[model samples]
Target: MAFLPTTREEMLQQGYEQVDFVYVSGDAYVDHPSFGCAIITRVLQAYGYSCAILAQPDWHNDDEFTQFGEPRLGFLVSAGNIDSMVNHYSVNKRRRDKDYYSDEGVMGKRPDRPTIVYTQILKRLYPHKPVMIGGIEASLRRLSHYDYWDDKVRRSILMDSQADLLMYGMGENTIVEVADALASGLEAKDICYIRGTVWKTKSIEYVSDYIMLPSYEEVCKDKRTYAKSFHIQHENIDAIAAKVLVEPYDGWYVVQNQPPLPLTQEEMDFTYSLPYERTYHPKYKYIPAIEEVQFSIVSNRGCFGSCAFCAITHHQGRVISTRSKESIVEEAKRITEMPNFKGYIHDVGGPTANFSREACDKQREFGACKSRECLFPKPCNNLIVDHSRYLDILRAVRELPRVKKVFIRSGIRYDYLMYDKNDEFFDELVQHHISGQLKVAPEHISAEVLDKMGKPRKELYLKFVEKFKQKNEQFHKDQYIVPYLMSSHPGCDLNGAIELACYLKKIHHTPKQVQDFYPTPGTPATCMYYTGLDPKTMKPVYVARTHEEKAMQRALMQFTYPQNYDLVYKALKTAGRMDLVGNGPKCLIPYQKPGHFPSRRDQGKRYGQKPYAKKGNERKGMKKR
Candidate 1:
């Protein structure tokens, strides 16, 4: 169980003249199961294919890429675990200074779009070698979609990267099929019929029984057409029920086959049981990305809670897949034996912790519903709301020989928990799982905003909160719920933000951080961000696109902070909520004199200036930037 060869010397030491595949990635090599590059490379190795890794190769030239030389089969490329653009920029489109995926958390180690950059570089260097791109970046951009950073529609990445194929979704199964085909002497263009892949085709004369989406021209020209096209794509996400989808360009069509079938319990067990180093490569002293997942165990894959802002539904699909309880506990025992074992397992969950089985029995035979959601609007009657299996696994891990505590850090769907008639799992969760705080996403309290987010209504979250409080009290514990709040989602305006701020005031809860709606590609909310229409219904939606408005919405969430006083005051005044602006008990803030909202003392050093301390204390703490 050695790490994959990264240099030519290491490849030669392994007694190989040339590897079968050279996997390029934007992230530092962390051969943990949590990283997609690790999974794909390890799976290929299991199938008797020699592979080498080119982790975060310098994109300035082909010098670094030549380390692995050429492969016998082809090169598999991914933009790390996260999309490179999202990794490099903030929600405000500002270039972020820290990248967790790089050595020492440095930024600019990889270019903005590594899938495109790396593939284009490979094509120029190798010319005829097969190139395939996958990972969150390629999976989301496999179709023609909106580009938030560019502020325009972009064509499929397959067309731009000149890569022969783009594998969307979890690529364990898709990679094997494509790799086998390539090994059998099939060219990239000829390997078109595999599921969970998008490929370029000059003619669809042989294609049959596929839905032809609106051409790239139509979606770019008309917002309504774009909305309609996005909705059509959303409806066909399930593998069992979905048909082949084709998006037309001027000359060629980008065809997406149905998603790969969800993995079975046996397959899920085999995937996690593979030998992995479970840490970053020894070359680097430290990588910030490996801290959280070093001791974590992934119990499941895929999510059914189809939030509009999340791309999990698009990439992992809504179908839930789980590992057997024995498989999970076995991993926990191994974690206990690590040299740095701390008597604690950081996490025992995946996309959603409580989802340990299929959404319903029908989901296995048929697929998740095409027209409606399983939890949003309301829980489906057919929805199976049980957490017993997950509870059993948690109990088993806790009883392991050297493990002292097991915690669940990944999100738990509170709405789904609230819908269950049985409260045993809920009670035990409050007692055992949480580490003094349970984090959940309510997103927003406004009904309109929640609707646009495809989240449950506010009433459901409130009920869950009350139940959580009751459970904590019953166990004689002091626990709190750290609700994940977002601002300026597609349907949110000044009034919506104000409504959420008022709710926070009522509950005396101010979030430590608020997530501004980021419109990355391949999400229903992103489609709304670009077209100003809800892709689900094609109705007009209010979007806070202006910088001032988006700031106001964000500030309203943290209205208690002195730094946000000015923005919050303006938001309240513009919304004509003057009644709530006075010095009453229910007032958000005291009225300040006109043009003198926040004093210099109140502004403090938050505005990039040295604080003016009191005259006597000035000499006590005087530091210059």
Candidate 2:
């Protein structure tokens, strides 16, 4: 009688259609409607679920790496923009000029990204699907960590990326409870009973307790010896069973472990009030600067600045929850109704972005209270400070009417903006929101690797750069803030890089850039930048930790980019520091090697490098010397 339309009345009429769920990410970074994993896969397809992202995953393209539309069921993985626990550590050499320029990999096997061949080409083309994995480089390699640039003990990234599970931290309620338990069909060994997750069945290893970082190196050298070392408790122990060996010619098993239960500020403010729209509406669909650009809103997460070469104090737990400011002006009015709404709102402070909502008075008791971030892992507490409801939600989304200016552009804990009684939110963030230059990290000038990267006191970043150059010359406006400095971390040397080229030759200020310190995966200074030695002064230091000392610490963070100022002023006057340059001050950084600035002449034809070439060897600029 009804000539057509009857696949159960076309599935009883358009309601449940949650497709494949594929995700993937090796790292391309912010481009689609401006990414945060394409706004967390468009907040899991607006909570109905049918996601599909895939940035750098080619895995020898079998019809373009499987997942042919629907029935694929599972697979998330994610380098989540390189931090896959700092890509296993080479410290990407002295943190090489912003966003990891290279420690190992400028190119070579990208086949898309996050390799073990993106999990052996998604387990030889989805033989049974359900892969999972999470970000912050698979949650600091999910288990059995502590590499410190490979000094040892590493295995449990679900046993090196064979991955059938691993969600780890900051995954907003474990990604909507693993997409409502695989849309209620379950199985991948019953989604490993879910917690902060980590599973494996046909060989055994089901970890659930989740925090873990120091998996060795004498428990990453103490914290009551790594919480009585990676526990196997058994005492009042709720659940346990051991004797494992997943491979040494694959045989033994009996593993079953359960322990993780720490997330709560109402589960971190219900993962910062996830409805996560930040624009792209007409019923939704707009992630494209290639994916995302300057419209991220967090308000706060975890970061007590315990630098020990940061792993965000082993992934977001030094507790600091915050979200309120009327849920950040309704996520900045959903990033100003999208479709490229750039009234500038790139990032709104968190993880040390002015210690939001005062880190709920000491969450994980790291030697209990007595602030200034438990002493110089920096954020210097003149204590008691507040963002006055995050500067009244950045002055009510810059007085909205199509919001145009509101960038506290991320990293700015300049010792809590020189906290002399919270200097008027650091003088109204250097007179109304700085966009030109303010990045601040002060990783090291080396008070012995800022007390092993817990930082501060290298004479307090020159008294917060002479109180931010006398509050920008009392607003005479010469505005510039830039000091993210980190140089060869683990107790640095060359007397800590010539005492950081003699404190930029007595703070006249020469740093066009300098982050030289690489050791990424599971930090604590990647075991002192890959064991050049300094397990607390076991001597012998000056390690750039190779790759030619991180290319001379990436040509030593351009000591003032006037084309590497005469070879960074002849390597800071041959590491002698020429009595810190002159005249009233602010500009005297020459260790030579800055050559042809303007981003190496806009990376001259992308490294064929020909901006009026004649200097030879890739057009090496400046230096008539």
For TM-score, the strongest prediction is 1
| Pairs that clash in candidate 1 | none
**Model 2: per-residue lDDT, tens digit, 298-360?**
677666566766766555545466666776777678778877776777667766767775443
User: What's the CA error at residue 83 for candidate 1, in Å?
Assistant: 0.8
- Report every candidate's CA lDDT: 0.90, 0.54
TM of each candidate vs. truth: 0.95, 0.32
Clashes of each: 0, 54
Lowest summed lDDT window (length 10), candidate 1: 616-625
Q: Which candidate should be chosen as best, given lDDT against the real structure?
A: 1
Query: Candidate 1's residue-wise lDDT over 146-265, tens digit each?
Result: 999999999999998999999999989889999999999999889989999999989999999999999999999999999999888988888898989999998999999999999999
RMSD of 2: 24.7
